[model samples]
Target: MLDSQSILNVLRPVQDPELQKSLVDLNMIRNVTVTDGHVSFTLVLTTPACPLREFIVEDCEKAVKTLPGVESVAVDVTAETPQQRSLPDRQGISGVKNIIAVTSGKGGVGKSTVAVNVAVALAQSGAKVGLIDADIYGPNAPMMLGLSAAQVKVQQSGQSEVLEPAFNFGVRLASMGFLIDPDQPVIWRGPMLNGIIRQFLYQVDWGELDYLIVDMPPGTGDAQLTLAQAVPMSGAVIVTTPQNVALMDARRGLRMFQQMQVPVLGIVENMSYFIPPDMPDKQYDIFGSGGGQRTSEELGLPLLGCIPLEMMLRQGGDRGIPIVVEYPDSASAKALTSIAQQIAARVSVLALA
Candidate 1:
């Protein structure tokens, strides 16, 4: 018969799929028993409806079966309640905090880029901030924050656990991209998407954040609904290009937030114009002009700022260095910084009121 210690040694290779930590390290392996070449154990999961439970169980079984003299492996999975899953007496983020959602009607309007820079800028302003890449289908906050492909270490407290979000540019971040391969698509339905959003809110160790900026996916879809229902957002920032098509989409995005009773913070016009470095004064309206300003005015919202169409912005995003950080003195960078300050001021006023 395999000794309990020997069985544990074999089982050490088993990992919780979602948590991505060894069962042994997570302290999830419980009630290990060995008798007559039969090994039995309990696997405590973070959630009762944990989607990866079956995989974890199979992995545990396979690992134990590899041990000499192990004839049968019995694995039972159990889940902890949300309260039980959290550290003891730990309070969640307070109500005084603001949760802002940065969204767009369509993609490619630099929504994620704006989200990343805004979060970092807020952090730079000394507010304890966190960023959630709630765009399940296209999680780019990890990449924008220079944390793409980074794995966060999950810690356990008795029967509870918490995910440690990765940090970059002085802001804490959580993204679906971090949990799955970048090439793999998140083909999840509404319910599954809701669960994922909740997990990010309650399972991650986002301690004492003054603001949590959620980078929402484009469109008025299940992801947006999930965020509206799961968290009380202070406001939403709509990103759009200075074009009619983008403005139409921005209108839909703004209306969705308003319908959900989330405040429309303002509109940010991206790729507003292009100014070649050689001729700084010569400005070309690449995507046309005044769409963002018009949309904001029509929606009765503020035109927060306009981000120029610049190669550095794209290059910075691709390289995990936001233009705001890489070229703070540039016109576009300074514009974003000023926008960041304006957002901070607006949120601060709301907090006071």
Candidate 2:
């Protein structure tokens, strides 16, 4: 029988490609199991999107196989993205591990829909998640989450008053929409916008969270810059439609995040296709096709998932229920869930790194 200690020794020589440190030293080796002559263990990677994942896996397997008594080596690769390294003058969110900004270049591409669904899906998967409607001028999260008439409550915490976030679909949510009357319009200047963004980020009592998804305003504007600079974001996801116009804006959004030193996690093509329930076999390219893929390829980022145009998706949003929760068995729901899984996995891995 090969002892766990012996297996650890074998893996000690295998270093993570990115970190260039022994796996043991990184504390990435998990669930070591030895049965007869076969040895198996899991390698917890820094990011599921790690470009060198294959290299590390192969190296780990080879190292274990070289042991004198080893008959076979089995390695499982898992990832957890590390928390963003704190930036100067910006304190980390209380109990938040990772922050993901969901943005687009132009509006009407269903960016908020994507953000809300992704947050709900992550929560459904047993992870603590928070959602922030950072689009101050056009706050729509309250309506989308079915909390349009809801108001943010205040709680006294010693010397400070914390804003309580609304809850629905298993996600904690903060939005200016909750505070302002639905019929009123916000005509604030840049300074006021910055203050609102800061208050939502720092004043809300978002208890320890696994992920905080920020639904960013459309375009590269002051609000976007304020949010990006105020938080040490783990990464960002660009949402676009399969149309040249949407793609053009999405490219700008991607570049903006990259320039701010925030990693572009991937691109999601919203409204990729439409299929009527009566005619399930035919697919309609309502917004043209391949724009998201082209943007992802041209920019060297991953294409996370393509969400289809469907009535269920719209109805779920209007009813304050995410499609991921309302129609988990539907194709659209599956795509959203898969994308959520990818985001969570990548975020966890990156956070660890």
Candidate 3:
């Protein structure tokens, strides 16, 4: 019999790669229908940015084709991001399912670039994404995300004020840059910084976001501590250039997250190599090579992906555009996009785990 029950029964053997559980049992396969030897169903994934989306779809098709009287398989794909487990001492932002931090050990590792591009990539894949430039003193995300001149709308929600985030490239953004003049410098101490981060977490009108990516300041400091203590995080990603000094700092940052009980998702090696404009065929490891892999191996973490150095990458950031948006086909853009997918995939795994 070519029916919905037969469809589900066939799909029961297809497990989600990351969750390692049967798709039908996980409620990922739904709305099964059959008519005239034709089959159709919805494949609700854990994340829109799932790296194995094509593979999963193909697997489902193969499984259904084996059933009798099946002419074709039509799998409509969608995603429902799962929420991170809550902590007794920490509070979660309403409407935000997962909060992940993108951090580097010391500064100048292009952490903001990685954070902004990753956020945009997730949003590009049909996920509701937000970014918090928690680097209060260096809120470069607004400029990098093409929203430097934009301002956050403040509305009084009862007694306290709730911020309306700026939007661009399908991402919601909150940053000190929106509040300060271009030439202004923030000279606040730990307490002031802590208060503002808390406000960003609880006082922002981030309506129904799948992932909120926090761009943390370099090093293990007050900003990291405040976030760790204040909210339940899905995970944290460490960004570092392929050098000994940067790798040392990355390790320090990773340990801080582990110590604070936040799952360290993975490490991203930025500026792993340089690709000259004229010679796209050649790659030079100006920052040394294989350092990210070695460090990840030593720390027992996955190396998410490595990004190359290109003149256009820096130009895109300075010109208020992310490389992923400006040059999607370039090597650096492709790497960042893959890294973003990897991050989303990891978050899905963590949520299910």
lDDT per residue as tens, model 1, 1-353: 47878888888877655333456755578789998988888887655776767878888888887777888989887865422533322223553288888888887788888889988888888888899998877788888889986889888956768889999898999888877766665564345787888888888888888889888887877677667656666778888888888867876676455444466789999889998877877889977899988998887888889988877888898999988888887778888888888787777776676
Kindly provide the TM-score of model 3 when superposed on the true structure, using C-alpha atoms. 0.75
* TM-score of each prediction: 0.71, 0.73, 0.75
Best by lDDT: 3
- Residues 1-353, candidate 2: write the lDDT tens digits: 47888899888888765434566755678789999888889887545786877888889888888888888888888865433322335567979989899988888788899998898889999999999998877787777778777767999999888899999878899998877765675664346888888888989999999999999888877677677778888899888888887766776676456545577789898889997877766789977889888988887778999998888889988887788888898778888999999898777777677
| RMSD of each candidate relative to the true structure | 14.6, 15.1, 16.9
Estimate the lDDT of model 3. Answer: 0.86
lDDT of 3 by residue, 143-215 (tens): 8988888967899999989999999999999997887776755665345998989988999899999999999
Q: Candidate 2: misplaced stretches above 4 Å?
A: 1-88
Candidate No. with top TM-score = 3
